[model samples]
Structures are given as structure tokens and as C-alpha cells.
Target: MAVQIKICGIREDRALEAVIEAKADFGGFIFHQSSPRNLTISEASRLTALAEDRIQRVGLMVNPNDDFLCELAAHASLDAVQLQGSESPERVGQIRELLGVRAWKAIAVASREDILRAEAYADTADFILFDAKTPPGALPGGMGLRFDWNLLKGLDVGLPWGLAGGLNADNVAEAIRLTRTPLVDVCSGTEAAPGIKDVDKIAAFCKAAREA
Candidate 1:
């Protein structure tokens, strides 16, 4: 079966067009200021207002509170929220309740214990994101780093899950083959620079993911 693809950290018109044209399953917009890919509420809506009808629109944030979450929901048109910090399952439930929308929790995975930890959110979070654990003091994610795929082998993840971190056209197929991830998310892997999304790369990544 073809794996679902989520092209993340999209901030430009060309990138948005590439994702929509490529028929990606999801497209993500960053709301955290620490990353270069971060976008304001108006900016995210400007880039994705039309895309909301074409594909799933996700808002990516890091450890935001209820007020911050409410502000984004009121200003931006998003189908889901991806929380990428050390948020508890209770917090994930709060986000879902506050927004009345699907909320995903991103876990930094480096070991089997991390996978077990993710289960805590199974009942609360709408989805689970297993991403690479970034080094200390670095941006939360989108750093082009990958964890050992073997750690996830034969593991029973009890909820809807996706893989993120260091996925590109050249290696996404392998990642899919190894993890059998239903959904694969990419950010820096499809970019030309820190935050610049290359349209060609986006197209190729989608084609690779679909054919995988």
C-alpha cells in the first residue's frame, strides 16, 4: 500500500502549490519562533487558505499553552494541531478540547522506552509523531537528524502514528520499508536551505513516497 505523506514546514506559495499538486496527504505550517520555518497566523492562512480544501492543513507548535493555542485557532484556518514539545497526555487532551480539532503529539524517540511513553497519549491525542531526538539547545525538530529505525521494528504502536525527521526522496522509501509507517512527515529534508522549500524536491519526495 502507498504510504501517506506529510510535507512539513511549508511557508511559500510555490511550496504550497507543489504539495497540493503532488497530492500529498498533509501539509504542515510551523508556529514556533525558534525555527526558521515559523509562520505567523496570518502568514500561515495566506499560504494555506486555499489548500484547506485540497488537503489536510496542520499547524506545528512547540509546548504552547491554552491561550496560545486558542489564538492560533481563532486566526488561522487549520485542520489539526501538531504539538512538538514535552507536553503530557493531559495537555494533548486539553488542546483537542480547546480547539475542538484533532491534536497530534510529537515524541522525540531514541529508545524503546520512548515508544512506551507515547502510549500515554494514545487515548488523548488524535495522532502520534515519532521524530528524531534533537541535540541539546537545538531547534525541536526539522534538523535533518534520524534515529535508528530498528528500534521501532515489530513494535505495537496502539494508535495512529507517523514517522518524522531526516526523510528525503532518496531514503523515504527505505524508511517506509523498515518502519511501515502509514504516514511520513518531512521538513528540512525537502528544503533547499534552512527554511526554503524547493518545489522540485517536494514533487520528488511525494512521488517517491507514493511509489514506495
Candidate 2:
């Protein structure tokens, strides 16, 4: 089976079109205020409306409050919510129950131990996103930083998980081969500049992911 592709941090219509044209499975909207790729709920709603049924719309957030999450779900028509903060397993469960959307819990991975820790959220989350571990004073995720893929070797978490961070056309195939991840998430990797997505790069990343 072909690996699912999620082109993340999409801000422009052209980038959205590129993902659609490439037949990507998921589109991500960053709702965190800190990130350069951050999108207001209204903005994400407009973009999500355009992609209605064409792809799954994923809303990315840090440890958001209830009101923020409610507003996001109401406005964006999100198919899934990715919690990329220091949210605990119970909080993930609460988000799942109250939000009524699939939960994609993101865990930063630096080693096999990190991957093992992800299992704790597997029961509550619909999917687990493995992002590169960031040092202090860095962005939450999608910093285009890569981790050791060999660290994931022989790992078997029962839930569906995605490989993310520093994934692009050139190295996506290798990442896929190394981890055999069911889904791949690309953000800065497909961008021409920081938070500026390149249409061609998006297309290329999607194609490579599918072919892998």
C-alpha cells in the first residue's frame, strides 16, 4: 500500500492546490500563535472550506485551552486535531472526548525510548506523529530537523503513526524505508523559505512519498 502523505503548515491557496493535485491525503493548519505558519481560525476555515472533502483537514495546536479548541473546531471544520505540546495522556483523552475529532498526538523522538513513550498515548489518539526532538528555545515541531531514523528500527506501536520533521523529496524515501511509517508529514521540507511553502516542492514531496 502507498504511504499516506500529509502536507503540513499550508497557508496559501496555491500550496493547497499543489497538495490536492498531488493527491495528498491530509492537509495541516497550524493554529499556534508562536509559529510563523500560524493561522487564525477564520483563515483556516476558509482554506478548509475550499478543500471540503478533497482531503482531511488537520488543525495543529500546542496546549490550547478549551475555548480556543472549541473555536477552532467550529470554524475550521477540522477532520483531526494534532496536539504538539506537553499535553499529558489524560488531556489528550479530554481533547478526544470533547472536540469530537480524531486526535493526532505528536511526540518528539530522539531515541528508541522516546518512541516507546509514544505508546502511552496510542490508546487515546487516532494517530501518533513522531517529530524531531527540538532543543530549548526552538519551535514546537516542523523545524526541518532530523532525528536518527535507525532509532525507530524494529519498533512496533499498535496505533497508526506518521514520520515527520526534515522530510523532503530527497530523503523521504529513505525515511520511509527506514521506519516504514504508514503516514508522512512534511512542513518546512516543502517550503521555499521558512513558513513559505513552495508549490513545486510540495508536489515533489507528495510524489516521492507516494512512490516510496
Candidate 3:
């Protein structure tokens, strides 16, 4: 099967249009306050509306509360909600049930044990995203750090999963060839600056993933 792609931390119309035009499978909206790409619910809703029927809209949250999730679900028509915090498997299940949307858990991979830990969410989450763990006091992701892809060689986590962290047009093909990840995700790799999505880079990344 062909590799699927997700362009994350999308905050504007041009970037989202680039994602759709590039035929990426998913477009992510960051809801966390610390990230430069964070978006208000209304902004995300508008972008989600524009992307309806064109691309899968995913909302990213970091240890969000029930009320926040409820508010987002009521307004944005998201295809999935990605939890990038320390949410437990049961909490993941509850959030999935409460939002009535696909649930994704992002695992920060610094070692083989981190990858194995993803199995814990296999039954609860609809998808697992393996991203490089950032340093202390930094954002959870989108910091452009990548772990050794060799760790994923010949691995299986019993559920659909994707690779993220530090992927760009230049290295995406190599990343895919090594990990054979069914899906690939990019964030700062396609940016002109923090939170600034570059259309040309987005196009090139998608082209590279497709050709791989």
C-alpha cells in the first residue's frame, strides 16, 4: 500500500490548501497553548470547514480536560483527536467515546522501550504516532528532533501507526524505506519559520512521500 501523509500544526488557509492540494491524508490543528502553532477553536473550526470532504481534520491537544474536548467537538468537525500528553489507555478510551471521533496517541520514542509502550494503547486508540522525544522544558513535538529509525526495524505494535518528528522532503523517503511506516507526519520540517508553513516545502514533502 502507498504511504499516507499528515501535515501537522496547520493554522491558516494557505497552509491547509497546500495540504489538500498535496493530497496529504491528514491535516492537524494544534490546540495546545505553548506551541507556536496553537489555534483557537473558532479558527480551527473554520479551517476544518474548509477542509471538509477534502482532507481528514485532526485536532491535537496536550492533557486537555473534558470540558475543553467537549467544546472542541461541539464546534469543529474533526475526523480525529490526537492526545499528545500523558493520557492513560482508559482515559484515551473515555475521550474517544466522549468525542465520538477517532483517537490517536502520540508516543515519544527515545528508546526501544518507548516503542514497546505503544502496545498499551493498541486497544484504546485508533492510531499511534511515534515521535521523537524532546528535551526537558521544550514542546512535546514539532521541535524537529528525530530518534534512530533503526529502532522501528521489524517492529510491530498491533495497530495502525505513523512516524513523525524531523521529517522533511529531503529525508522522508529514507525514513519510509527504513521504517516502512504506513503513514508519515511532518510539522516544522515544512515551515519557513516556527508556525509558518511553506507551500513549496509541503508540496515537495508530499511528492517525496508519494514517490517513495
Candidate 4:
């Protein structure tokens, strides 16, 4: 199957248009307050509405509360919610049930144990995202750092999963070849600066993943 692609951190019409033109499978909106890519509920709703029927929309949040999730759900049209913090399996399950949308858990992988830990979310999360673990006091993800792809070789977590962290046009094909990840996500990799996406880079990354 052709590798699916998700271009994350979209905050502008041009970026959203580029992702749609590139035909990426998903576009992500960051809802974390500290991140450069963070979006307001209003902003996310507008973007998500613009992307309706064109690309799947996902909201990325970090240890969000039930009230905030409910607020976001009332405003934006999201296909899934990506949990990028220390949410337990029960929390994940509750979020999935409460939102009535697919839930994705992002696992920060630096060692074999981290990858194995994904199995804990099999019953709750609809998808698992394997991303490189950032350093202490650093942002949770989108740091343009990558772990050893060999760690994912022959991985089977009994749930749909994707690969993320530091993927770009040049290395995406090789990343796919090594891990055979069905879906690949890019954030800073296709950016001109933090929270600024480059249209050409987005197109190139999509091409590389599809051709892989």
C-alpha cells in the first residue's frame, strides 16, 4: 500500500492549501499552549472547517482536561485527537468515548521498552504514533530529532500506527523502507521556521511518501 502522510502544525491558509494540494492523508492542529504551533479553538475550527472533505483533521493536545476537550469538540470538526502527554490508558479510553472521535496516542521511543509500552493502549487508542523522545525541558515533539528507525523493524502493536519525528523529503522514503510504517507524519521537517510551513517542502515530502 502507498504510505499515508500527515503534515502537522498547520496554522495558515497557504499551509492548509499546500497540504490539500499535496494530498496528504491528514493535517494536524496543535492545541498546546507552550508550543509555537499552538492554535486557538476558533482558529482550529476555521481550519478544520476549511479542510472538511479534503483532508482528515487531527487535533494534537498535551494532557488536556475534560472541559477543554469538550470545548474543542464543540467547535472543531476533528477526525482524531492525538494525545502527546502522560495520559494513562484509562484516560485515553475516556477521551475516546467522550469525544466520539478516534483517539491517537503518541509514544516517545528511545528504547525497546518504550515501543513495547504501546501495547498498553491497544484497547483504547484507535492509532499509535511513534515519535522520538525529546530532551528534558524540551517541547514534547516537533523538535526535528529522530530515533534509530531500526527499533521499529517488524513492530506490531495490534493497533494502527504511524511514524513521526524529524521526517523530511530526503529521508522519508528510507524511513518507510526501514520501518515499513503505513503512515508518516511531518511537522518541523517541512517548515521554513518554527510553526511556519514551506509549501515546496510539503509537496516534496508527500511525493516521497507516496512513491515509497
- Where does candidate 1 stray beyond 4 Å? none
Candidate 4: residue pairs that collide: none
lDDT of each: 0.89, 0.89, 0.95, 0.95
lDDT digits (tens) for residues 1-212 of candidate 2: 88999999998898899889989999998988889899988789899999998999898999999998888777778888999999998999999898898999998988888899888987788889999999987888878998998887777788888889889999999999998888899999999987799988988888888788
> Which of candidates 2 and 4 is the stronger one according to lDDT?
4
TM-score of 3: 0.99
lDDT of 1: 0.89
Per-residue lDDT tens digits of candidate 3, residues 49-140?
99999999899999899999889888889999999989999999999999999999999999999999999998899999999999988999
Q: After best superposition, candidate 1 residue 188: deviation in angstroms? A: 0.8
- Model 4: per-residue lDDT, tens digit, 10-48? 999999999999999999999999999999999998999
C-alpha TM-score for every candidate:
0.97, 0.97, 0.99, 0.99
Error of 4 at 133 (Å): 0.3
lDDT of 3 at 160: 92
Show the lowest summed lDDT stretch of 10 residues, model 4. Answer: 1-10
